[model samples]
Every structure is written in structure tokens, then in C-alpha cells.
Target: MTPILLIEQVLNGLQSGIMLFLMAAGLTLIFGVMGLINLAHGSLYMIGAFAAAAVAGWTGSFTLALAAALAAAALAGCIIEMVVIRRLYDRDHLDQVLATFALILIFSEGTRWLFGSFPLYLDVPAALSGPVRLPGGILYPSYRLLIIVIGLLIAIGLFQLIARTRIGIQIRAGESDREMIGALGVDISRLYTIVFALGAALAGLAGALVGAIQSVQVGMGEPVLILAFVVIVIGGIGSIKGALVGALLVGLTDTLGGVLLPLFFGLFMDPSSATTIGSALASMSIYILMALVLLFRPTGLYGRA
Candidate 1:
């Protein structure tokens, strides 16, 4: 209702968008570079959350938990790429989809077996457990602020890596033509593995970070995965900039719509009815935004023709 409350909601939206960017960035990277549709990317995200939760429970160190998440997810990604995904690269999209879909089931059941059906709680570190005062006397959760900062830092690092690093050139080449990259002695298979692992690591990082704010539970990644797919579709497959912009747009639209729509409708209707209608519309806002964007720019904002 108030401007301060609106600002807080905006910040929350930004944090949510940042997490989505983390998830979508990897997805776009994998599809862009490898031409593979990995339905199991969400599995990697779940693995990361479980890894972080388990390690945090044992060691009581958030830092170590994060490292464990990155290592576990990256290792899982490497293995999946080598043992299963490698063979599917040359196959059609249907085959890739089917195989990855199977991987999702396998990962979910395996995780449930290991972690059980109960959700694990990851406590925010003592250092970041409280709210911090911001400009205009607004206070926000320090952990969420950290998440936003970390996400933005990762985004910058990814941009630099793709634009300036040697591996980046090879990745771009692979995206353009895998055969040419192989002809150049760049070891296309190795590049693919590395890219997939990197993508998985990012997803895992997102899962670990968000796990603190939400429950770290089995099959936690599926819902986020759906949103991430919507993100990529809105942003354009394989476009990092588009992912960032689209994610922010989705996040802001979703959060603000939920908060604002009820108020807007309440102006002319009963509170209960307004709340019901607003919640329904808010839930569909991101998809509506996606459809509008696609209608105008099929390739998405920042996507190449």
C-alpha cells in the first residue's frame, strides 16, 4: 500500500528474478552450446539443495555447504553427460527429451531414497540471519540481499567468461558449428562436458542459495524448472542477456501482480472476492507476459533473428 512496502516488494522481486537468472543462465548455455534439451537440469538443482542441506546439517558451516553443493552438482552433471547425455547428442530432440525425462525420474527417486521424504531445513548463517537497514529506513533480510549480490556477481562473471575467455571462444564456435570446433582440435566432447557441468553448477548454486529461504525437499526443482523454461522461452534459447531481462520482467510481474492486483480490484469489490480474483490472475501473469513477448518478438528480447 505504501511506497516503502512497494520498494520492499520490488526488492523481493529482484531477488526472485536473480535466482531465476541463475537457473535460466545454465539452461540457455547448455541448449545454446550443446543443442540438447535437458529435462533433468532440475534434478541437478535438487541435488545441489540436498547436498547443501546435508553438509550444513553436519558441519554447521554455510560456506562448506555451498562448496559441497557446487561439487556435488558439477560431479553429477559430469557423470550424466559422460554416461548418458554423450550418446544422445547426435540423436533427435525427441530422443534427448525422453532420455532427460527419464533422468529426472531416476534422480528424484534416488534423492528420495537417500534423503527420505522429509524436507530438510537450511538455516541462514548467523552472520546473515537478520535484516539490514537500507536507504529510506527500509529493512530487508540480509541473506536475500546477499543472494541478490551473489547472483549479480555471478552474472557479471559469466558475461566476462563468455566474452573474454579462451573456452568462451570454443563455446561460441561449438554453438555455431560443432564440427568446425572439432576440426580445430578443440575437443568438442570435452567442451560439452565442461559446459554442461558449468550449467549444472550454476543451477546447484541457485538451489543452495534459495534453500535457505525455502525448505530443501525432494523434487523441489520441478516447479522452478518450469519457470526457468518459461524464462528461456521468453528470453530466447541460448541468450544470456535475454535470460536476465526476461527473468527480471517475470519476477517483477509475478511479485507485483500478486501484491497489486488485489489492491486494484479491492477498490471496487469486496476484499475476499478481490483477493481470489487477484491471486488467480497473478499466478498467470508471467505466462501472459511470456505470450505477449513471444507475440511481438518470437526470438525474444536480445535474441538473434
Candidate 2:
């Protein structure tokens, strides 16, 4: 591959990694602080996409659409927490998984009912629709670059939020000892709701941003959600720092493997066979990385023993 092509692929990897971080961050936070295994997290992602699509279509404003997506997802998360999730806090993991899985069905069917079976397309805003020249004479899509910037900014913001604020202290305390915090007069229930809604909002924002590039449709979030889970597992289930590192590692490995592996194989074999075998291996690269990591760390890079 040419230098420009390599640069582009690296950027693509970075973009993919950052987006996965957005998904995984919320997941890790929820698990770490609330001890909830929410299978319906992906449904929240889908809700964001649909909300953005619907609002954008009606208002013809991308900004407004994004706001709507965040609001809708957060509201939905709060409602679900209040009505169902709160009850599951003390339940076994199996029960939590089953209940959230049921929620996935409800969300999927409800979305289909409202949006019909067709996919919704979100147009990239006019201002960000074109490509920009990068440092190495490489032209990159402006919107994708924006995603990278936004993702990084959010990461920084999250770090600050969790490290510098009063809420952050409370969150950390809750994670360490929920019962102690509650005994000290903290409204643990309200805090849980806030964290859940915050997580949902993050997922929703990811879905909305990604929907502009990919088709907005029912079940789009499942594949991403699965990847997000891999990210958290590889990063360490309760570690945001682990999520960031793991996401970037998975993204780079997957993207580079897909491009470079085929080229490497083509040197020794027929182009067709090389392409097929390379693609297959490329798809499995991240899982292989995960297995290797687990073999050593077991609990993941940042997970506690």
C-alpha cells in the first residue's frame, strides 16, 4: 500500500476505535458502578439513531437531531431504570440478562412498528460532507475527522468528570461500597438513575453519529454492541482506561489486518485465494488477540484479581 493509503487506514482505525470507546465506556461505567448487566444497551443505541433520523427529517437540522437523540435515549433510560431496572439491581446476573433481553425484543418491535421495515438514511451535514487534506497530502472525509475529534473530546471530558467533580467522587464511592454510601445518606437510587441515563445518552450519541455514515435501521446496534462488549472484556470490565486502550487495539488490529494481510498473502499466492484466506483471518484477528490477552491476564488488562 502507498503511504497515503496507509495513513488513511490508520485514521480509519482511529475513528473506529474512538466510536467503540463511546459504546464501551458507558457499558463499563454501568457495570462498575451499578453492577448491572444491561443487554438492552444496544436498544438504547438504536433509539438514538431513530430519534436523530426522525427529528432530522422533520426539522432539517442535524444539530437538533443530535439533541433529540440524546434526550430521547436519556429519557428512555430513566424510565426503564425507574420502572424495571431498579428492581433488577439485587437480582442474579441470569435474571438481569433475561429481563434486559426481553427489553431488546420490545425495543426492536416498537422501533419497527414506528419506523416501518425500511432503513433510514441520515445525510451528512453540508458543511462536513467533503474531504480535507491532511498533513501527508492525504484527503480524509471531514465528517470522519469530526468523529475522531468529538470522540477524543468526550474521552477527555469523561476523565475530567470522573476525576474532578463531586459527582465523580460519589460515583467512585458507590462503586467501592454501595451499602456504605447508602448508609451515609446518599440517595443511591437517584444516583443509579443518573448513571444509567448517562450511559444511555453516550450510547445514543454514538448511534446518532454513526447513523449518518451507515444505514439507520432496526438491529444496527447489535453488531456494534457485540464489539463494544469485546472492547470492555479486553479492556477490563470495570475500567474506562482499559476500554479506551482495548478499543484502539481492536480497531487498529482489525483495520490493519484486513488491509495488510491480503497484501502480504498476495506476495506468495494467487490473488484470489490470498484475498479469501486473508479476509477470513483478518476477521478473526481481534478475537485471537482477546484470547491471548485472557490467557495471561484472565480478568483483562485493567480488571482486578
Candidate 3:
């Protein structure tokens, strides 16, 4: 591939990585603070996308759509936490998994019932619809570039919120000892609701941003959710820094493997065979990386013992 193509692919990978970070960050935070394994987090993501699409269809404003997305997802999260998740806080992982899986079905059917089965389309804002010229004659989609910037900003904001704020202090303390925090008069239940809502809002924002590029429809969040799991696992569960690092690694590995592996194989084999083999290998690259990481560091790159 040409240098320009390589640069574009790298940008594409970075965009994907940042988006994954958005999903994984919330997942890790919830897991760390609540000790809850939430298989339904992806449902919140789907809720965000659907909410954004529906609102955008009505108002024709991306900003309003995003606001709706955040509000809907956060509200959904709060309700779920209050109604269902709170009850499961002390349950086994299997129970949490089964409960959340049922939620996925509920969310999918509920969404279809509300929006119909047809996928909704979201238009990139007029200001972000086209490509922009970059240094070294590279051109990239403005919307995708915007995603990278927004994702980075969110990352910074999350770091500051966790490290520099009172709420962050409570979160860190709760992660260390929930009973202690509760005994100290911190309303642990309320804190749990806030954290869950915060996580849902992040997922919603990711879904809204990505919906502009991909079709918005039922079950759209599952694939991204799986990748988010991989990201958190590779980065170390409950570590935001690990989530960011793992996401970038997986994104680049997946993007570049698809492009470069085929070229390498073509040098030694027929084009068709090379392409097939390369594609298969590319699909497994992230898993292989995960395995290697686990072989040496079972908990993940930054996971605690």
C-alpha cells in the first residue's frame, strides 16, 4: 500500500480505537466499582443510538440528538440499576450474566417494537460531512477526525473527574472497600446509581457519534460490545488507562493486519488464496495478541493481582 493509504488506515484505526475506549471505559468502571458483570451494557448503547436517531429525525439537529441519546441512556441506566441491577449486586456472576442477557433480548425487541425493523440513518452534520486535507497530503473524513478528538477529550475529562474530584475520591474509595465507604456515611446506593448512569451516558455518547457513520438499528451494539470486552480484558479489567492502551492496540492490529497481511501473503502465494488466508489471519490477530498477553500477564497488562 502507498504511504497515503497507510496513513489513512492508521487514522481509521485510531478512530475505531477511541470509540472502543468509550465503551470499555464505562464497562471497566462499572465492573471495578460495583463488582457487577453487566452483559446488558451494550443494550444501553443501542438505546443511545436509537434515541439519537429518533430525536434527530424529529429535530434535524445533531446536538439535540446527542442530548437525547445521553439523557435516554442515562435514564435507562438509572432505572435499570434501581429496579434490577441493584438487586443483583450481591448475586453471582452467572446470575448477573443471565439477567443481563435477558435484558439484551428485552431491549432488542422493545427497540424493534418502537422503531420497526428498518435501520435508521443518521446524517453527519453539514460541518463534518466532508474530507479534510492533512499534513503530508493526507486526507481524512472530518467526522471521523472529530470522533478522535471527542474521544480524546472524553478520556481526559474522565481522568480528571476520577483523579481530581470529590466524586472520584468516593469512587476510588468504594472500589477499594464498599462496606467501609457505606459505614462512613457515604450513601453507597446513590453512588452506585450515579456511576451506572455515568457509564450509560458514555455508552450513549459513543453510540450517537458512531451512528452517523454506521446504520442505526437493533442489535447494533453487540459487536462493539464484544470488542469492548476484548479491549478491557487486554488492557486489564477496571483500569481506564489499560482500556485506552488496549483499544489502540487492538484497533491498529485489526486495521493494519487486514491491509498488510494480504500484501505480505501475495508475495508468496496467488492473490485469491493470499487474500483469503490473510483475511482469516487478520480476523484472529487480536485474539492472538490477547492470548499472548494472557500467557505472560493473565490479569491483563495493567490488571491488579
User: Could you tell me which residue pairs clash in candidate 2?
Assistant: none
Q: Give the TM-score of candidate 1.
A: 0.98
- Model 3 global lDDT (CA atoms, 0 to 1): 0.94
- Per-residue CA lDDT of candidate 3, range 42-144, in tens? 9999999999999998999999999999999999999999999999999999999999999999999999999999999888899999999999998889999
Let me know the TM-score candidate 2 reaches against the reference structure: 0.98
lDDT of 2 at 36: 92
lDDT of 2 by residue, 1-305 (tens): 79899989999999999999988998999998999998899999999999999999999999999999999999999999999999999999999999999999999999999999999978889999999998889999999999999999999999898899988888989888889999999899999999999999999999999999999999998999888999999999878899999999999998999999999999999999999999999999999999999999999999977
Could you estimate the TM-score for every candidate? 0.98, 0.98, 0.98
Query: Lowest summed-lDDT stretch of 10 residues in model 1?
Result: 296-305
lDDT of each: 0.93, 0.93, 0.94
Q: Give one digit per residue, the lDDT tens place, for model 1 in 46-79.
A: 9999999999999999999999999999999999
Worst 10 residues of 2 by lDDT: 166-175
Evaluated against the true structure, the overall lDDT of model 1 is: 0.93
- Count of clashing residue pairs in every prediction: 0, 0, 0
Error of 3 at 13 (Å): 0.5
